[model samples]
Target: MSRVLVVDDEAGLRRALAINLSARGWDVTAAPDGATALEAAASTHPDVVLLDLGLPDLDGLDVIAGLRGWTDVPIIVLTARTSSADTVDALDAGADDYVTKPFAMDVLLARLRAAVRRGAAGEGGAPEVVEAGALRVDLARRTVTRHGEPVKLTPTEWHLLQVLVTRAGRLVTQTELLKEVWGPAYGRETNYLRVYVAQLRRKLEEAPAQPRHLITEPGMGYRFEL
Candidate 1:
C-alpha cells in the first residue's frame, strides 16, 4: 500500500480525494492548509504528495521547499493556475508533476502511480559522477562543480541537466526532456528547454555564446556531448 498526502483547502475536494484514494487501496492523509500539510508529510512520510498551490496558510511553493529541505519525496502540484510561468515555478521548486484543477480522476491516479514508480526507481543504481570538460556532476550527492567551484542550479535546471548527462553523447528531444523533467503533462513546451539549457550552458560551459558541451539540434532537440 502506498501512502499519499493530499493537501487542499477545499473541504469537499479534500474529503472526496481521501475517499477515492482510500477506495483505490492507497493509504491517504488529507491536509487543509500548508502548515498541516507539512506536518502530515513529516509524520506520515508519504510516498507521494498531491499539493494544492492556493493554501490558506502558506503558498504551496513554500511547502514544496519545506518538504524538499529534508526529503526527496515526489511532489505533484494540483492547482487552478494555468499559466506556463506557474508551471515552471512549481517545477523549479522541486515538484515532480503538475496537474491543473478540474482534472479527471483517472488521469490524476495514473500520474500518482508514475510518480511512485519513479521515486522507487530513483532510490539506487545511478552513476555517482559524470564528467565533461571542467564540469563535474555528482548524481549521488545532487551537486555540481565547474572549474573546481560549485555551480548553483535551481531544481528544474539540475533535473534538465541530469536527464541529458545521464544519456551523454545523445540528442534528447525537446518533448522527451520536457516530459522527463517537468512531468507527463509537458511535451511541446520547447521554450522551457531553451531557457534552462541556456542557463546550464552559462554555468557549465566556458563561454555560453560558444558552448562546447550543450549543443542545440535546431528543430530536432538538444544534446550533451561529453
Candidate 2:
C-alpha cells in the first residue's frame, strides 16, 4: 500500500480524503496546517503528498520547498487558487502536479498515480548529461553549470530546460511543453511558457534579448540549439 499525506486547512475535507483514500487501500495521513504537514511528512515518509496552498500556519509553497530540501517524493497541490501565477508558483516550488478545488476524486487519483510513475522514472533512464554552448546540464544530479559556475534554477525552470535539452534542435510545441512540464490542465496557459522561457534565457543565454540556445518559434513552439 502506498502512503499518502493529505494537507489541508479544512477539517471536513481532510476527513473526507482520509476516509476515501483509506477505502482505496492507501495509508493516509492528514494535516490541518503547513507545519503539521511537514512534521507528518518527516515521520511518515509518504510516497506522495496532497498539499493545500491556503494553510493556516504556513503557505503551501514553503511547505513544498521544505520537503524538496530533503525529499523528491511526489507532491500534488490541491487548492482553490485557480490563477496561472499560483499554479506556476507551486510548480516552481517543486510540486509534481496541480489539482484545482472541486476536482473529481477519480481524476485526482489518476494524477496521483501519474505523479508516482514520473517520480519513479526520474530515478532512472534519462540522459546523464546535456551540453549547450557554455551551459552544461547534469540530468541525474539535476544541476546546471555555466562556464564552470553553478546556475540556480527553480524546480519549474529546471523541468522546462530538461524537456527542451532532451529534445535538442527539435521543435517542442507550446501545448506539449505546458502539458509535460506543468500538467494536462495547463495546455492553454501560454503565459507560463513566455514567463519561464524568459527566465531560462536570462540564466542560460549570452543575451536575454537575443537568446541563442533557447529559441522561440513565433506563434508555435520553442527549440533548443547546442
Candidate 3:
C-alpha cells in the first residue's frame, strides 16, 4: 500500500480526503497544520504528500523545503490561490506539483497517481535527450543546456520545457501542458503557462521576444519548433 500524507487546515477536507483515499487502498495520514504535517511526514515517511498553502503554522512552501531537505518524496501543493506567482513560488520551492482549491476528487487522484508513476520512473531510466536548435535537454539528468552552455532553470521551468521538447514539432495544448506539468487542477491556468513559458524562452531561446523554437499559437497552445 502506498502511504500519503494529506496536510490541510480544514477538518472537513482532511476527513474527506482521508476517507476517500483510504477507501482506495492508500495508507492516508492527515495533519491539520504545518507542524503536525511535518511531524507526520518525518514519522510516517509517506510516498507522497498533498499539502495546503494556507496553513496556520508554517507556509506550505516551507514544508516543501523541509521535506526536500531530506526526502525526494513527491510533494503536491493544494491551494486556493489562483495567482500564477503563487504557483511559480510553490514549484520553485521544490514542490513536484500544484493543485488549486475546490478541485475534483478524480482529478486529484489522477495527479497523485501520476506523481507516484513519475517518482518510480525517475529511479530507473536511461537518459533521454531531446534537442531543438542549440538547446539540449537531458531528460534523465533533468538538465538543460544551450549551445553547450549549462542553463539554470527552476523546477517549474524545467518541467514546462521537458513537456514541450519531448514533443518537439507537436502542438501541445494549453490544457495538456497545464495538467501534465502543474497538476490536474490546473487545466485552465493559462497565466501559469504564460509566465513559465516566457521564463523558458528567456533561458533557451536566442530571441525571447521573438522566439523561434517556442512558438505560441495564441488562444490555442504552444509548439516546439526545431
Candidate 4:
C-alpha cells in the first residue's frame, strides 16, 4: 500500500481524507498541523503529502522546505488560497502539485496517484547525465550544475527541467508538460508554465532574455535545444 500524509488544520477534512484514502488501500497518516505533519512525514516516509497552507503552527511553505531538505517525497498543497502568487510560492518551495479548497475527491485522488507514479519513475530509469552548453544535469543524482557550480532548483523546477532535458531537441506541448509534470488536472494553466519556465531560464540560460537551451516555441510549446 502506498503511504500518504494528509496534513490539514481542519479535523473533519483530515478525518475524511484518512478514511477515504484508507478505504482505497492507502496507508494514511493524518496531522492537524504543520509540526505534526513534518514529524509524521519524517517518521512514516509517505509517498505523497497533502498539505494545507493555513497551518496553526507553521506556514505550509516552511513544511515544504523542511521536507525538501531531506526527502523527495511528492507534496501536494491543499489550500483555499487560489492566488497565482501563492501557487508559485508553494511550487517554488518544493511542492509537486497544488489543489485549491472545494476540490473534487476524485480529482485529488487522481492527482495523488499520478504523483506516486512520478515519484516511482523518478527513482530509476532515466538518463544518468544530460549536458547542454555549460549546464550539466545529473538525472541519477537529481542534481544540476552550471559552469561547474551547483545550481539549486526547487523540486517543481527540477521536475520541469527533467521533462525537457530528457526529451531534449523535442517540442513538448503545454498540455503534455502540464500533465506530465503537474497532473492530469492541469492543462489550461499555461500561466504556470510561463512562470516556471521563466524561472528555469533565469537559472539555466546564459541570458534570461535570450534563452539558448530552454526555448519557447510561440503559442505551441517549449523545446530544449542542444
> CA lDDT of each candidate?
0.86, 0.85, 0.83, 0.86
lDDT of 4 by residue, 1-226 (tens): 9999999999999999989989989999999988898899889999999999999999988999999999998888898975656665676577776777899989899889877876886778556898889999998899999999999999999999999887565456777789889999997899999999999999998999989999986655687876
| Deviation in Å, model 1, residue 112 alpha carbon | 0.4
* Residues 141-182, model 3: lDDT tens digits: 999889999999998888888888765544566777898998
Please identify model 4 stretches exceeding 4 Å from their true place: 125-226
Count of steric clashes across candidates, in order: 0, 0, 0, 0
Query: Which structure is stronger by TM-score: 2 or 3?
Result: 3
Q: Give the Cα error of residue 68 in candidate 3, in Å.
A: 0.7
Residue 36 Cα positional deviation in candidate 4, in Å, after optimal superposition: 0.7
Model 2: residues >4 Å from true position, as ranges?
125-226
lDDT of 1: 0.86
Clashes of 4: 0
Backbone clashes in model 1: 0
Q: Give one digit per residue, the lDDT tens place, for model 2 in 112-191.
A: 77666656666775568988778999988999999989999999999999998775654567777998999988888999
Greater TM-score among 1 and 2 belongs to 1
TM-score for each prediction?
0.61, 0.60, 0.61, 0.61
